[model samples]
Structures are given as C-alpha cells and as structure tokens.
Target: MGDENTPLGAPQLAREAKDLVELANTEETVSELLRRGLDWLTRIARFDLATLFLLREARLVAVAARGPLANARVRGHVLDLAAFPMVRQALETRRARAFTEEDHSGEGDPFDGVLDLPPGHSCMVVPLCSGERCYGVLTLDRSECETYPQTVVDLVEVYGQLLATALQNAEQRSDFERLHRQDHEHAKLLESQLGGDSEGVLETSLSPAMRDLARRARQVAETDTPVLLLGETGTGKERLARAIHRWSSRADHPFVTINCAAIPAGLLESELFGHVKGAFTGATKDRAGRFQMAHGGTLLLDEVGELPVELQAKLLRALQEKTFEPVGSDRTVRADVRILAATHVDLQQAIAQRRFREDLYYRLSVFPLRLPPLRERLEDLPQLCAFLLDEQARRTGRRGMRVLPEALARLGAYDWPGNLRELANVLERATILSRGPELGPQALDLPTHVRAPEAPAEKLAEDKPGKVPTLAAVQREHILRVLALTKGRIYGPGGAAQLLGLKPSTLQSRMKKLGIARQELFIIEGPT
Candidate 1:
C-alpha cells in the first residue's frame, strides 16, 4: 500500500465509497454498527487507532474503538465539550479537521490523559452528521505524523454522513419497538381489569331492570361524555363502569382505575396526575399517574366522592380542560382520557356539607347512571349465582360445582345490605365449605338472621346428617362469618379480628393461610 499522504485514484476511491455505504446500511445494533465502522476507518485511513463517540444529553460518550489505543478503559469514556475543543469544532462546523501536538502547545492536549497519544501523532475528527443534526464524532489517530490526502478526507466525510443517517434510523426503530411493547402490555392489563369475558354478563342479565340499565349504558358508551355511576358500595358500579368502557369506542385502549379512598389524602394528587423525580420524600423516580396511564383511553375514578376538597379544584380543571400539571412539575400534560367517576356517596348531601364541590359534581355527572341494588333484582339471583360459581370454579380449578335450589331460595330470602359484593362473599365461603359438587342450604353458612323462616331450622337440621368438621374448615368458616358481619373490616372496633378476639395481624395471617382474599371479602361484585 502507498503512504498515508498518497491520494487514491478517483476510480479506486469510488469503489471504497460504495463498500462503506453498504457497510453503513447493514442492519445491526448501534454499538455493533459503530464498532464495524471504526474497524473500517482504521483499515481505510491507515490509522492505528479510532474511536466513535455518540452524543447524549450534551456529553460525548465513547461507544466503540479499535487499534492499539482501544482498551476497555477507553470505551465508554465521557468527554466534556469544553475539554474536547477540536471535537466540538468538528461537530459545530460539520466538517473534518486534523490536529497535531503542535496545535496543543501551551494548551494541554484534550486527549492527553484519556488517549495518552504519542508525540507527533496526527488525529483527525470527523462529524457524524446529516442535514443540520450532528449525532456525534468519529476520531482517528495515526502513529506517524502524516497528513490525510484530500481524497481520503472526502471519503471519510461521506462515511460519516451515511453513519449518522443509520444511527437516526436505528434510534427511531428502537422507539417504535418500545412503544409497541407498551401498547401490548397495556392491552393485557386492561383485559385483566375488565375481567376478560365478564363484560358479556351485562348483555345477558336475567332481570328486566338490569336489561334496561344495560341498554342505557350501551347508549351512553357511544359518546365521550363523562358518566357518573351512582350506587351503594357493592351494587357493581365498577363493573358497570368497565362495561361502559368495553362498550365504548375507546375500549381497545387502556382502562385504568384509581380508587380515591384507597390512597392517602397526601398522595392522592400524585396518584391522579403523576409526579416527577424528587417530587416527594418517597418519590425517587418519575411515575406516570392514572391520568397519564389512561391516555387515549378511559380513567375510572372509583370511590370518587372520597376525594379531598383541596384537590377537587384541580380535578375539576383536568375534567374541564383535559390538562393538568404533575406534582412538582410546572409543565402541563394533556391527556385524551374519557372520565368515568363512581361513588356510593350522595353528591347532593356532600355538596350541602361543602365536602364536595358543586362545580365538579356538575362536570362529572353529565350523564349520571344509577346502578340498582341486588335486592331490587332478586329474580336474577339464580343466573347470577351460576355465573359467579362457575367463575370461581374456573379460577380455583374445582369444576362441576352447583348451588342447590334450597340454597338459592335462602340467598333470595336475605335482603343483601352489602349487595352483590356480599352475595359473592357468601358464595365463595360456601364453595370452600362444601365437600361435594352440590352446595346445599347448610353449605351457605348464612348468618342466623338471614336464614329462611320457611325452612324450619329444626327440620332442616334433621334432613342432613352432621359430620365432624376439620379444624381448618371450622376456623375458615368462623372467620368468614365474622368478616361478613363486620363487612370486611379487619382493624379498629367492631372489626372481624376484634369479634374473633385476635389481633389484626394474626387474623390476616390466618386469612392468608386459609386462602381467603381480602378482595373477595370486600370488593367482589357480580357482573350485574
């Protein structure tokens, strides 16, 4: 090969340029591509060392290197723009420039400590740039003091441009892949929230009242209007809200739920609107809140009436303008989210007490929907029981379990003060207690007050032979009964643990061992 100063003929240079273009267009990761590019540069430019530095947040990081100077220590070396004047100049001017030891006379060499370059070596910095954007710089150094011919410099410049374009394409592709994965994960999460295939229960409601309510819900689902779901604690407001989301045009997107009463008053704002890093004592990193998570989809503010008065104004603004600032962040974020608010609290009474804002109530209740309590639709009991029992069986891997007519009659006799949630709890307990496929009235374990009087307690007790119950079974049944009586409260006075004469933590441990989920006791509601 000729010396470094000997310029290549036009024809040979053209062939070299074609090969470099093909190398730049190869489908590889950014790091791999940069490494291969550096190898090509060292070979073609007759340089002993080469380094590829990518720009990240105003700092240049050495991503790939080759030759004698390339070592593990040199890779990932970060350079400040102020220190690497020639690199900065090349990036700013979008040109290739050569520097020697003479250029650093009185001024210390930028690469002195980092590269430890020998005296009289020539270093050329080429800007990896396309259009007006400079992705980074490519630096090559030779062992000898030699100038790069005009032809070699031109070829290197062309290589830099092609490499920059490839880097941009790779970054864009990576972003697209990340977004696609996020969308798929969100879809799965929403599917779980809606309780996959549970939305169909509303369509097949046995009760005429429920059927009519489903019809109105479907009508409202077609619109983007705010819907306020009104009902008692266990009347299936959340189920109805999810049905509305599934029925709406935004069903394909996220269906995020945030229980206002579930989070503390101090953290509720951050939960709704999100927060930046260092926003609060426990907030170590940025978090996207319910609103941001539900972007381009639906956001259900469950138990919305429990929201504090101070945050109501901010919530009202978000609803009215679809814009809100994150906690500790002045930048406003706008989300295209459909609002669905659910509450058992009477907004009228709350407004009178000044506990709820009248303006927020008006904005939320644009199309209010009141869910009927389970007692109002006892005719649907049999179908509802079948669906819930089948679902529980599928979940627990215990199949072919059926409820007896006597048990159904007993269930209907009781006025469900806790509504659908109470009924679900009763069924789950009965499922656990029943040893056979059939769940009889005895299996129900209903509180004495709600037992059907027509069944004549003495006669019903005589009908079935009693067997000694397992210690675990007895304990589970007794805990379930107390929890039902306490309406799922575990701590404080009148709670299940207090009635059972056990500490809250001890009761919780027993509950976990018995496979009794707190959600089943408190929040499990039928699809109606």
Candidate 2:
C-alpha cells in the first residue's frame, strides 16, 4: 500500500475517488457535502481523525469533524489565517504537507499548541484548491506505528480537489438564488407602479405642479430613503405615497399604513413594534405590528407628526439600526421596510415647540415632496372635472355626463379650501341631483361660505379680453345675487330655491357642487 507502483492500489484509489465524486455531486448544501466527505475519509482511508475547514468571512471555519472529536463544539471552531501556519502554508502553496516524527528535528513541532495530534501519530494537511483559489485546508491523522501510504495521500488530494469544485458550485447556486429573489421583488414593484389591478391613480396629467411632484416622487421611488409628503388636508398625500410604493423596489411586498393621530398613544408602540402573547392584558396571542407587517415593502406613517416624543427616540433607533425588539420579546427582529410619512401639520413648528424630535424629522424628511393645493392649480379643473364626472356618472348610473363651460368657470372662481376631497364630495352630490345631459351652473350650487376670487373693478375686466358672458356665468351670478337677497336661505317661500324654480334640496346640492359659500359671497357683496 505504501508503494505508488502497486497495481491494486490504483484500482482502490480510483474506486474511492469515484465514490467521493458521487457523494459530492449528490449533496446540495455545503455543510452536508463536507460532512459526507469527512465520513468517507475516516472510514475508507482509516484516518483516526478527519476535519474539514472551509473559508467563511475571511477565516477558516471547522464546518465538519469526524473520528475522535465529533462534537458540536468542534463543528463551528474558527481558525484565523495567522494562528495556524501549517494550514496557511498548505492553502498558500496549494499542496499537501506531511509531518512525521522523523521530520520534526530542529523545528520542534509546528503542530504543537496548533492541533491536538495524538502521540505517535502522523498527519497530512491537504489544500482543497481548484484553479487559482483555495477554499480551505483538509487535515487527516493516523497512527505513526504503521507507515502512511503515498497512495492514501494521493487519494485524499483527489478528494480535496472534488470538494473544492463542490464548494464553488454551491456558492454559485446561492448567488443565483439571491439574484432571482431580487428580480422577483423588482418585478412586483414595477407591476404595482404601473397600476396593476389597483384603484389608485396619480392625477398629474392636468397640472404642471402635480406633474413636477410626480416626477420628483418617481426619482426617489427606487431607493430605500424615507420620504416626507407635505400638503394640506385632502391633497392626496396618501395617494402619492402609494405611487411611491408602487414605483419602489419593494412594491411586491405589503404597503401598510398607520394613522398615528387616529390611534391611541398608549397602544402606538405595540402597534408599531409588535408584541409577544403576554405582552399586555387582553393580549390573546402574538401579533405582528405594522412595521413587521410592512417588511420588505413600504410603510405609510400618516399623521406622523402626531407620534409622541417618547416614541420618537425608539422609532429613530429602529430606522437607524434596521432592528427592533417586540414589546415583550428579548429577541431583536430585523426591519427591511421603506418609510413614507404624510402630514398636514407643520413639523418645523412642532420641533420648535418640542412636540416632535428634530432627529426624527430629519430622518423622515430625507426626500420631501409638497403637493400643490387645488386653488393654485385651477388650470387643471377641466381635466379634473372630466375624470371626476366620469367617476360620478359610473356611481350614479348616469352616462356621458359633461360639464358646461359656465359650470367650470363657476368651479374655477372659488378657492377650494378642502382641496381634492372637497371637489370629489361636491361632484358626487351634483351627479346625484343632475337630470340633464350637461352639468350646468344650476346643478352646481356651490357653498356660499368659501372665499371667491376677488371681483374685477369692472364687470368687463372679469371676462378674458373679448370673452362674452356665457349663460352659465349669468345663471351663476343670478343665483348668487338671489341667495344674497334671501340672506342665504334656500328652503321656504322666500328662499333662493323658490325664486330659482327648483326644489330646496336640489338647490342646496347644486350650491355644494359649485364650491360657493354664502359667507364668502357676502364678504364680497360691496366689491366689484
């Protein structure tokens, strides 16, 4: 067995190599492959000890051990490159080295304090190398009373080569899986962004301001940065947040929302960070919080300005560390969520008053977007009305419902204090009351309490250049004058509705649809 020329030795080595190749090919996991390889070496090669150390995080880790030390403690033992010179030399030179009693003269013993080599035992360290890279070092030990065969050393070297190939294949497979997962996640986000089966839509088509806002939102949608949406109430901040989620890489995952102001302060922490089964009274079972539920996706923190000061520090820590412990659990869970914060409150003022944390604000406002109010984007009224009227028509069993120019002028004249939400409410009401093909001024009796555009010094100046008074405008003006004359009364005999030849309810609905307010009209009674 010690002579390489022995005819039987070649066939035995060939069979051992074939068995190892089959084992390496069949095992899927790296740990399993190493375990089987060590077992084969200990049994077939008659080694007293066999250990497989693989490179991990720039160090060699004892992934599998057999023979004398087959305990759990030996499996994860980590060896630094500088601590073991024999393993280092084997790895660097890409060659197997043998240490025997006769070869240990002046060197004293390189294996001393390094490996627990049994007394009167010989050892061989083989590099598990393929191509130019060495994956790790394989060590085998046996009694020195019998000569260690050169055939056995060659067989171990061949096994090391096959192990290196297996390790590389396993690593490549892991990389492929990771990339596939990332691609799947990206696809989901794109699908949502493209409005996949979702009722949400960005109304940026009719207004340049909205278009700009959408453009900025799209720019930051692919990143993991926190977004702060600043706008007045009813400006569609939540809708914009949804758009960001759809466009982000995490679109495939959940998009969870939490209204801080709507929830009680006492329950906010548990709601955000989750809790164990016995975290508090009435806690029947464990539940995931919004943060955990929104993992790998977007979390919309609506009215985030309402979060209490004490919770701000916790939130900041989670955002910074990407980890948080459940209410009653000592285990820290990871957070892989993108945050979108929406609020109508003045955060700067809140910070100044010590009601909000400055650090939290900075974290939340990494990319801030301010939505324009409806009054500032009146040019979009026609498109907005068209979309809204279509929605109203669908809801009210009406078809082809179009807004007259006069009705649009009436709508464009007033300041929409409630923004898009108010507009939707008014249009919905008008659709319910309309009995004609076109939505006329009579069908849009706007509230008389909101501010109207300042009247020009003269009636001629109000019309654009050569623009004549359309019947709608004339009707709107007439209705306003009568409402003022009746002191904003709509019901009864002397009411504006009676004078306008309409039912009181129909007239009231029209006023709401028109964005008119009696107080606003009365305020401008003496003006042009």
Candidate 3:
C-alpha cells in the first residue's frame, strides 16, 4: 500500500500469476472461480470498497463488488459516465491515473454528480489492462482520506495489473484443464476402437507425481538395477513394475512375476531355480524357472517380504551373480535376469524380528522407491476419477459414464482404504449401474458410511414406505462416519469427501448442507 509496487514481491507475483493460470485451466466453473478470486482479492488488497466492472458484450455489469455500500440501492444510483468528463477520460484512456482535480487543474466541469465527496471521502479508479488492452476498471474508496495521493494512485495501478493477470491466468487454466479432459476422452476412444488388451491399466494420471514417475521410469528403464518398489497394497506398485519392464532394455524378452507369499517354501525354490526331471517324485519333465524364462529380461517378485526365510538366502545369491542351478542338476544354468521386487510389508520390522534375513533386506532395498499415499495428493483426484471413469467405460462398452457432483462429493468425504484399486473398482461399479446419462448418485455403490442408514425398518413396515434418504441426511451420516474412521481427519485421510473424492468445492457444499464441521466431531471423548 505504501510503495508503487504491491505487497507481493517478484517471486510472489509470479507465484500468484501461476496460481491464477492453474485455477483458470481447471474444469471448475468460471463463475465459481471468479467469485472466489474476487472474494479473496478483496481481502488481499485491503480495500474497503472494491468493485470489478467489465464491459461484457457492449454492456457493463458489476460482476464482483465488495465493501459496505454495494447493495442494490447504492449500486443502482449511478451517474452518467459521459456527463462526467473525468470518468469518460479514465475509461477511454485505458490506463490507471487519478480522476482528481489536479489532473484537470480546474479547467474542466465542476465534476459535481460523480466526484461529490462525502465527509472524509476520497476515491481512485484504476484501469485494469492486459498488454495495452483495457480489461476492466477497479474503483477503490476510503472514508478517512482527504484526497487521492500519488502513492495511492500508483499502488492501485499495480493492484489492477495484478487482478488482470490473475483473471487471465484463470482463463488459461480453464482451457488447459479442458484440453486435459479431452485428452483422456481421446485415449478412451482409441482404446475402445483398438481394444487389444482390455486388462492393461490405462494411465490417466495428470498429476506431476504420476507424470514424474513415468518420466523417471523411462529415464532409468535402460539400467539393470534391481529396482525395489516400496508402497502400500493397491497402490499400483505392480503397475509401475510392469511399466518399467515394458520400457526397459529387456522389453523384447519375457517379464515374469512371482508372488513370494503365494507359493509354499518347498515349491518356491523349485519354482524359482527350476527342478531337474529326476529331482523329485512326480517331476514329470525338466522345467525352466521364472529366472531362466526371464533370461536377458526382467523378473518381478511381488510381496517380496512374504518370501520364506530359507528362500531369501537363495534369492539374494541369484540377484548378486545372476546364476542358479536346478534342484537335481549340479551344473549352473546362468541367466541374465534383472531383478525387480515389490513389497507392502515392513522389511525392516521383518528383519528385526528375524522373520526375514537382514542381508536380503539390504540387497532388495538398495534401490528402493516409495510411492506416495493417495491422501498426500488430493489435488489429483478429479483427474484420477476422470481417467478411471473413461477406463471403466472403455472396458464395459458404455459411454453412460459420468460421476455426479454428489457421488464425487460423497467419494471425497471418505478415505480410500484400498487406494487406487478401490477407486478403480468403485468407478467400474458406478459405470456399470449408471441408469441415465448423468451417472448420478444412483450409479454409485459407496459404502454404508457414505450413505445415510436405510430409514428405520419400523418406518418401512408402518406405511409411508417410499421415502428415500434425503441428500442432507446421507451427507450428515457420511461426514460423521468418516470422522470416526479417520478420527476426524477433516483435512486428513480416511476419506474426508473433500480429501477423498478430490472435489474440495463440492465437498464444501455438502459439509455446509449437512451442518458438519471439524468442531462438531471434536467433542471430548469422555461422554457415554
């Protein structure tokens, strides 16, 4: 407010501009974003009376106005711009400057109607422009100032520029989001048309985290490191492993997977290193183990933590030197297999307890990569959902795929116990049951907590039978249940709809309607 520049520094200005661009490129409605931007900017500028008026299709309507005297009566009382020479000049010039008497030096008309100052009143109108073109005007007023100062004039100009840039960013953001959405749709269209492997998971990710993973995978795919992927179950560890294999130097060869937990200890060694024909009873013929089969290629061991203690030693040896002997034969059958391992269990804990070998843990964890949990990246939900919806539509042969605001709202309210796998399944179910084009709440099969409890059995038995659980009721129960499950991670995990479904705006709506807040659930746990 004091300097010619706004309070924001160069870095802050750039960041705000970037944020506006990001917001503009979003799929959110422009009106909603504009209102939010206006609401926030009013506070940011610290101007008591601020109004944003733009020329829309040759007519100007004040879209966003703030401060005290902005009601119908105050706004309706208007002076003719042409009759007031100063107002006309400000609009015509398309640049920020004071409309005070100093500019004219008393050579112009009295400026009675528009510039008639109230007690201790002063005003400044700054033109909002972008690249030499006028976008709109910002009128800032204060009650205690005697006259518009030069410093105030300059600050207002900077403020106007900031707002204009922000508005531009919002528009650009909207376009980018629309393009991204269309890209997903295009991918689905290609999938359905070409439909080769329906089981292959489509990467609908737009989040930097996911895109960055893809980039890193592509970069390191040529290497022969024994990549150890660490993440929770249902977090797409297998998907990433497969992606690595598909992109790596061993892409032409077989990519084999062995779930260490699934096979027995006795069979695991035989399965991995292969058994000679005469190795044991009922050893019908010579067999090639996963390592031999994946020679000069990639071998993925899933749930590596669950591997038997005895087998861990052998697995380590094979990973170190890439050579193994069949169960019955003494000769070593060398295969150039690149090892990749995935685990959901805590290998360190297993090692400490002596349930898992420490050396094997070190060998596997040498090139460890940890995938982030879904809760850490709520911003990517909308994109993720859109991608999943398209995927479901492609597989099931239905374009009747759409996620209702309410379903998305309810989804955002809860935590995803199953992670991406759960999200995919829910989307698939919704797509399958979609009754109409909208794919509304009816399509969803959300958990009991996400829905209101079925109206009392007594109420159903007594006569007023067809009463559906009100939207408000469903929202209320959903909020409360998630609060309990997550211990009230209002902004935390256990799927707060805003956090879960990735629609903070929509979740906000439901939270308001249901009369729920963080405080309601924060009551002392001492009561019965």
Candidate 4:
C-alpha cells in the first residue's frame, strides 16, 4: 500500500467513484449486488477483509463478505444491536468512523471476538444509509496497524449510500413482479369462468340427435330440477352442463364446478361444503365451497360417481333441504343453487352393487340427458373441425387455418373412443404440425389401432356363387352412386345427402361406417 499520509489524486478518486456508482446501478438481485459491492470495496481500497450486514428484525445479519475466511459460515454471522456497540452506533449516526489498534480497550476489539481478527488490526465502520432510511452497516478491516485516511473513509461512505438505494430498488422490483404474476393468474381464472365458448357444444352441431338433445335441455333449463348428464368419458358432458347454465334464469350468477373424482374422499366434503378455520390440519382460514360459491346460480358436480359413499348422504340432505353445515361447523348455511351432476358410471349397476344410494340416484336424475358419442354422430365432424381449427388458430396466432377434405375424411374414419375432447386434442396437434394454412392428412397422427378397418375382399365377393351382397355392401354402393351424381358433394341442397333423403351429417356417418372414400365415389362408372 501507498503511504497513509499521501492523498488520492483527483483523477484516481473520480475513476474509483465511477466504478462504485456503476456497480451500484447494476441490474441484479439484492444478494448478488451486495456480494459484488463488497468485492469491489475490498479490492479497490486494498483492505484485507470486508463484511456487509443488513438490518433484519432489529439485528444485523452478515449478508456478504470478502476475505480468506469470508465463507458461508462468516456470511451467515449475526450481530444483535445490543451486542455490537460500534456497528449500532455507525447505523444510528449515519456516519463513517475509523478505529486503529490503539482505540481498543483491554477487553479487546469487538470484531476480534466475532471475526477472530489478528491483534493490531485497524477497521472502519460505514453506515449504508440514504435519506431517513438506514439499510445496514458496512465494516472494513485491515491487518495493518495504520489508521484509514479521511479520503478512504469518505469513499466508503459514498459506496454505502449507493448500495443501500440499490438494495431498496431491487426489493421494490421483486414485489412488483410478484404482484404482476398474481394479477395475471387472477385474470386467467376470470377468463376461464366467463369467456369460455358461449355457444358450447350446440355451436356447430349438425347431428339431429344433438339438436334433439339441445331442444330437450332448453325445456328443462328453465326449471331448477337436477339434470343428470350421462355420457362416456370426453363426451362433453361438462360443456352441455355449462350450456344449460347459460340458458337458465340464473345466467348472471356464478357457475361453479367441482370434480368429485379429482379430490380425495376425506377432503372432498370440505371442498363441496367448505370448512371453518381449524376444521382440519391445514385449514388455516375459512373458505367458501362450491355450493356456497354457486348460490343463486348452478353447481356442476362432475364425475359424481366417484363421490364417497359417506358424503353422498350429506349431499342428498343438502339437495333436499337446500341447506348444509360446513365441515367442523354446526351453523346451517342455505344456498339456492341449481345442481347438475354428470358421470359416465351406470347408477343402476352402482345401486345393485350397493355402492350408490338408490334414493340419491333418483334425486339427481330428475331430468336425465345423455350425450351421443362422436362415432354415433360422425356427420358433425366437418363443422366441428372447422370450429375447432378456427379456435386453435386464434389461440396460436395462426390465421385463416383450414383442414383439407381428405384429412377430415381420415379423422371421420377413426372410431373416437374419447369423443369430442379427443377430437379437439387431435385437431390442436394437427394445427401445430401443419406448416401452411391448410392442414392435410399428413398432419394427422391418429392411432392405427383405432382406425375403421376396411372389409376383406372375400366378404364383398360373397355375392358370387350362392352368396348375396350384405346390407353394408348395398348401402355403400348406393351412397357411392348418390355421391357420384352430386359430384362428391356431401352437404348443402342438391348434394348426395339431399339426393339420398338423409341428413348431411347422418349420411357422412353412414358413408364413413360403410368405408366409402370420395375418390371411389368419383371414379364409379354408372355404378358397379
């Protein structure tokens, strides 16, 4: 080191100040900024060691340190305000103070008791403060016996103030980011609740079966009677339930839904009826349940078959009386909620097996509505594909997306065991795989096992030698002739569907089932 008596040149001091200011303005986490700040001070000031402490809960915790022994153990060191008098005084005075070896009394240096510094060491304490707020104290130690010059003390004081301001800004930024994330999550939740497909399953459904179902659902929607929705998995029972809620008088009120199979048997009761604080192990506060949340609206209990037997009785009571007691609370709460329950389980079988209450089943199935499987309503594929593709395009920012007719035919050929939900997933995948605006057959990755198998030639050739064409063959030949007459047109007036006096969607379903391809229809020369 240079002579303690010699002053730092103005140019050198200006450069040193610039470095400290640049380090303080660095966009980094609070802990990282503090660590780098300490490193710069120790290296520039030529000090043997330096420690930065932050005030937390009336105590100074060593947050960052630089030296041979400045490991995790030293950085984690804590000093109570009452225990470290020099550090407390530095923070209270908002000033920098220097101490030499002669300043210590016989009791020994305060830092020596904690940091285990060598005897005859000099140190300086600078308060990391700005305005009226004091963040903490910065302590710099030197192994030499020389006192710190006034210039070095003043430089450290400026660094401390800059670091303190940076720490405050970093914390504020962290809080702002956290709040923004929470607001984004809340917005998504609200969107899911209110901005879902308004028309629901009825939007593009061309199947007469679905139209009839919608007509019946509208009749029952005006009434508060429990509507039991029965369908296979992925058959859009929840979508239909939402449609019914939208059509009902309570449309303005909240529409709440809960999956009975998703929650555990023990906690599902609390999820349905809510619980008071101290109701269970993790119940730190009171919460509204699905029933209370859907008051004056509709409550959909999805996968109702999975509800535990013990909770079914309480549910039945709530349905019958329009009142329920929350878990761990004796006070009765009443809710005017129109209940809709949906499940794929056969309740009659469940009753036979004594797994479900017969009374509860009758109570829930007051106005039962069954959703037709996709295979049974294959005519809806074209419209459904168009709607789904448009939805996916809008979501993924791919505009004017369309599916080729052959690709749609390929989709129709699959016996979708997972129904509409699976169709949506397949279309979404196709949209992602397609490079152009048009989705072709190559974009579809349908499972080979699920594809509708073609009839063996031997089965069709049975018409030769004491064999007659099967009904399927005759139907296929007739549909092919009709398609040829309409020039492969399946929809609209004067199309093959109209020529055959069949609903367009129904004709498509029959054609798919009969394994009739559009190319074969066009190639047919005045029938086979």
In terms of TM-score, the best-performing candidate is 1
Where does the lowest 10-residue lDDT sum fall in candidate 4? 519-528
Off by over 4 Å in 3: 1-208, 393-395, 450-528
Report lDDT (Cα) of residue 463, candidate 2: 68
Instruction: Give the higher-TM-score candidate: 1 or 3.
Output: 1
TM-score of 1: 0.56
Candidate with more favorable, higher lDDT: 3 or 4: 4
- Over 4 Å off, model 2: 1-206, 389-400, 451-528
lDDT, model 1, position 527: 32
Q: Write the residue-wise lDDT of candidate 4 on 173-237 in tens digits.
A: 77887998787577546644543563555744555689889989988999999999999999889
Q: Residue 284 lDDT in model 4?
A: 98
**What tens digits encode model 1's per-residue C-alpha lDDT throughout 1-528?**
334566556677566566655654565566766767666565457676778888897799888888887788778688888876767878888988777677667455556777766776777788998767788988878777666666677767776786787677666666777899898888777575446455667777755678888998999999999999999889888888888888899978888999999999999999999999999898999999899999999999999999999999999999989999999999999999999999999999999999999999999999998888987777567677877777676678888888775566567567788898888899999889988999888998777675434767787777744455778987786666555444567888656676667899999999999989856674323233
Clash pairs, model 4 backbone? 379-505
Q: Give candidate 4's TM-score.
A: 0.53
Best by lDDT: 1
**lDDT at 461 for candidate 3?**
86
lDDT of 2 at 135: 83
Where model 4 places Cα greater than 4 Å from the true spot, the runs are 1-204, 451-528
Better model by lDDT, 1 or 2?
1
